[model samples]
Target: MTWILVLVAIGLLSAVLLLRTRRTRQKNEPPLDKGIFPWLGHALEFGKDAAKFLTKMKDKHGDIFTVCVAGNYVTVLLDSNCYDAVLTDTKSFDLTRYSQLLMDRIFNLHLPNHDPVSERKRVNQYFNSSNLSRLCSTMRNNLQFLIASADTQNPTEWKKDTLFDFCYSLLFKAGYQTMFSTENDNTAKFTDVYEEFRRFDKILPKLARRAAARDELKFASSARKRLWELLSPNCFLTGSVTQSWMQTYLQHLKEQGLDTETQRRAMLLQLWVTQGNAGPAAFWLLGFLLTHPEALKAVKAELCSLQHLPLDKTEDTPVLNSVLKETLRLRAAALITRDVMQDKTIKLSNGQEFVLRKGDRLCIFPFLSPQMDPQIHHEPEKFKFDRFLNSDETMFCKEGLQMKYGTMPWGAGSNLCPGRDFAVCALKQVVHMILTQFDLELCDCNASMPPVDANRYGFGMLQPDGDLKVRYKLKKHN
Candidate 1:
């Protein structure tokens, strides 16, 4: 009996060792040109400069390369034709897994498990063009209130206040007002929810250490419990017609047999969808405008002319569209992240083969790189409002300045940001309100909005580092 037990234990140990060895071998066996210490991989260099790491690899290994990160092998695809091949291929790729990774990092919502059909259906309901149109009035009203409440004239106070903080606060207030309009008084409560969310974003990617990772998950769970408590009906949906409407909607969903957790996740999805990228994008637009006098002038001129246009008039505001488009192109929050799921071969227009392996990540970093590409835009570093203008065309065409791989601020294809149109409208209202009523200039002119360090993590997100002094000049009616 003792000899039989010993043999069984030996067999189990041997199997475990073999599995580990196989995984390690697979990790090293990726078919790509890996220069020096491929086992150590690009881990150290990537950790140092994640934004430039891919660019550097592209420089050394041409358009495609395979590198191991965190025990996972990733393939990067670059260059224009390769970009088109992946983006335009609708059926072959899915962003769900990558999107799930981001959701886990940011929201702690325990989402990303729904069937793709259901997920797409739900998201489409929320962000369909008609739904976005329904949101426009709410966004407009919220913007008006924010503008009326902003500290416009006090020069000294404005100078001391952080522009980034002000933008975040404005965005938070507007977002809350728009979503929970008379629905809840727990604006402060929701603010805490978002702060906790941001806290998780700041911490998650750095959780490579197992012990630290466990602690973060523990804290995140506790935060979620607290949030659930605060989000009780009495706290969140109360005291108004909108609240009643939301309650009815939720009840209908429950009657349709959606689980309680799914309902809660759906509510969370609504909250973040409204407040996420648009707010940061707005902040960046304003900050960038402060640096460029010509852009500011163009915006002011366009805004001043729009005073005569009716509120419902959508067309003829060409310059406002220009400002909005330029801002999105220049300073969008977040970058494109996709994992190459198949060992696919991409054929480029230049007659080169870019071979990509399964399970490798191709991250398109938007942190001051794409916006400053000299090859795409002449004098890329300068904030030229007309940089995106179709110079040869007599009419200002929206689609003409577009470059396939060059204009990727909102990403591309089916994964293209759903909230972009709504965001643009919201931002336009904000910019119009500010430019119309306020004389604005950088309060701390020396302060700059630079790329956030990789160690800190909140880069290309709602982070505008600057101070602006804005003074309200009452409109003169003749």
Candidate 2:
């Protein structure tokens, strides 16, 4: 029995060593699967320019290529043909694995058990189509308050301020209002938390955030416990409309006997999604707008036509909607990630076979693919706001659906963003406010549209690297 145990251990060690050697050999041999780098195994190459790196590889190695990640081979499919298979094909791939990693590291929760489908449904309930009016009103009130606060706090500096910062302020305020029912007027409190989160997110040498991730639970736990105390059935600030809607879900669960850990997780998830993407979206929109003057003008025109109130919006404004779509195509956030759930073979139309084994990462860099595709738009580099605006809605839909690359701003497939509607509504209101109130132009003489260093995570959904300093003059009518 002892001899057998020794043999088993030896066999496991042999397998690990063999896998490591095989991966190392694959790294040095070019064109076995193109984009294979020396020593670094495509890591260093990709680390430099994540956005266009894959596209560049595809230009050299066809559409299919493999890279060694954490000592495993990850095959990246470049075009739209396999997008459906990789992203939407649940039998083959799943986002839960990647989502779980992020949720655990960033939000300190178990995501697979969290029932993303059910959570999405619940979130859908919160942003239901019928409740569009209410949501819009909530968003508008939030927008007005954010803008007014910015104006009040920094009237003169507001013009010279970076649009990216403005985007952060807007997203933070909206998220605070939506989840907490209070505008994030506490800049110090908000900035401290946000900066801390951002600092933690950066995985740098000697700066680990594992402890900080634990602290998220600690913070949520304390907040939930305090809320329970402040409002035991009948409450003052607790009964406020904003607090009720935001906190009711958890409050109801507590009444029904939820465990402390479970309740803490639920609250954290609620807070995470509301705040995570808002700031990034704002930065991207402002960055794109700063670069593309014509696009910004069209967006402003659309906003002017649709806006009835100074702070709010009317139904869908087409031009503004198009501008938002185009901007997202140019800059969306949260890198689209998926996990290989099974030993799946991806068969290419060209008769190439690639095997994606279980536990491998399937990431789509839509930021690079969507905006740079020549077939998708005329003059891919130039910002044409109406590129997505087709005369026939059906044709537009087909054109959009057929785009294999450069089209995945919010990602594609089943897990495509559930919060897209809310994001669009919020962005439209913010852009409308900015355009209606201020005449904006790029103040940074050196910068152009889609500023460089946009791609950080080697995914296309990168926001501009720095704050977009824009010249803002009060509109003549305003």
Candidate 3:
């Protein structure tokens, strides 16, 4: 009798779900794929390989289509034609709200829900033209200290290290000290907090699930607590002469009447944001150079030519800048997402229109649409070091067209990343320093490009599935 009742309950649930799905399809929505499972939807398939899945769908259903993933329907715009719609339609689409949702789920904390525009403006001020020169000097000093310290035991021998780990450690320390003060006495304690934060970051996909179990929640909670403890006012505020960017941020939080715990959580998020994309990006940029000998030779020659110029003026090295741009294009799996605040009609450049209802999500996968579009980038799969350089020593473009939204590694419009300028400068400095100060080579010259972690698709930069080993020895002059 119990078995029969269980079967009846399952049957009723399936019937209701079928009816709801039919109703959703009846509306004038983009083509929806619910996949095989009911509520699970296309989450598994989409998670496995986002670019390929989206490409197959785009080929079948034009540039616009919807896919149900974990009970939410997301409409993807997959061509340059629809770029303006995502960038300009800020009134109907809200990126901040979407960002907040992800942050809340992953961190398991409720941040003060407020307009981020003012915050963005304030942060941008810190990275403005006047302040960048000083910041760059600080970063250079930090990088030099890190590299020098690593060779204390045996300076003459080549050190074998994983590029990802080395970059992450160096960047995390440098970025932390640059934004925050370096006066803290508890370096060991802060290092502990950083490790915990990394562990928490790795399990974000599991934690984002609505049905996340207690064990997962417990781990995330513990990590957050440790981070909060380390970033407490007593620890973070002490031992700094000049005012750090974090000090100003803390002051703002205090003025907003947020509690100490909230402020710490906010700081943790900031720490993650500042160093997150940079480490992986630096790794890929250097990795690409190591694998391609011709590109390496050209970039090295460019660096040699610019040796007479001031190291602070990274803009002078246009070839290195082009390589960085290409790396961002190839490695960044940026998923620009917006929540539909109200019902709206989205008209594309190709004369097709779609009605997006309230609560729906609109996303653009730049990895597929623009970055790998052969129409815009010839031989998009291959790494061309000078792809973004022109004969006139200016930025390259597609078919003599400007293409404003063509290469959006940092993003577009009001939603653009505030740390973009700082990130670019930091990457250039790291690469320039590495090339000039060290003699480096891949342990395995035949090692292919590292596979991108598909789960990190929507989170700005894509990380490698695993670390790659490289051998290095300090140059005599450095």
Candidate of highest lDDT:
3
Candidate 3 lDDT, 65-96, residue by residue in tens = 88887767888887565676666777888878
Instruction: Write one digit per residue (lDDT tens) for candidate 1, span 92-151.
Output: 555667667655555444443544435445545665765665666777877776666554
* Candidate models: Cα lDDT each: 0.56, 0.58, 0.76
Clashing pairs in 1: 74-360, 75-360
Candidate 2 per-residue lDDT, tens place, 72-150, comes to 4566665555676676676677756656766665444553344555666666676667665577677788677767676
TM-score of 1: 0.75
**What range of 10 consecutive residues in model 2 has the weakest lDDT sum?**
203-212
Can you list the residue pairs that collide in candidate 3? none
Those runs of model 3 whose alpha carbons end farther than 4 Å from true positions after fitting are 1-19, 24-28, 185-190, 209-218, 239-241, 305-315, 391-402
Candidate 1 runs further than 4 Å off: 1-40, 87-91, 112-121, 150-160, 180-182, 190-201, 204-225, 232-270, 308-315, 339-341, 359-372, 390-405, 445-447, 450-462, 465-478
Which residue pairs show collisions in model 2? 50-458, 80-404, 291-449, 367-460, 369-406, 370-406, 370-407
Comparing 2 and 3 on lDDT, the stronger one = 3
RMSD of 2: 6.5
Q: Candidate 2: where is the Cα deviation over 4 Å?
A: 1-17, 23-40, 153-159, 182-192, 201-237, 240-272, 309-316, 347-355, 391-406, 444-455, 458-461, 471-478
Error of 2 at 168 (Å): 1.1
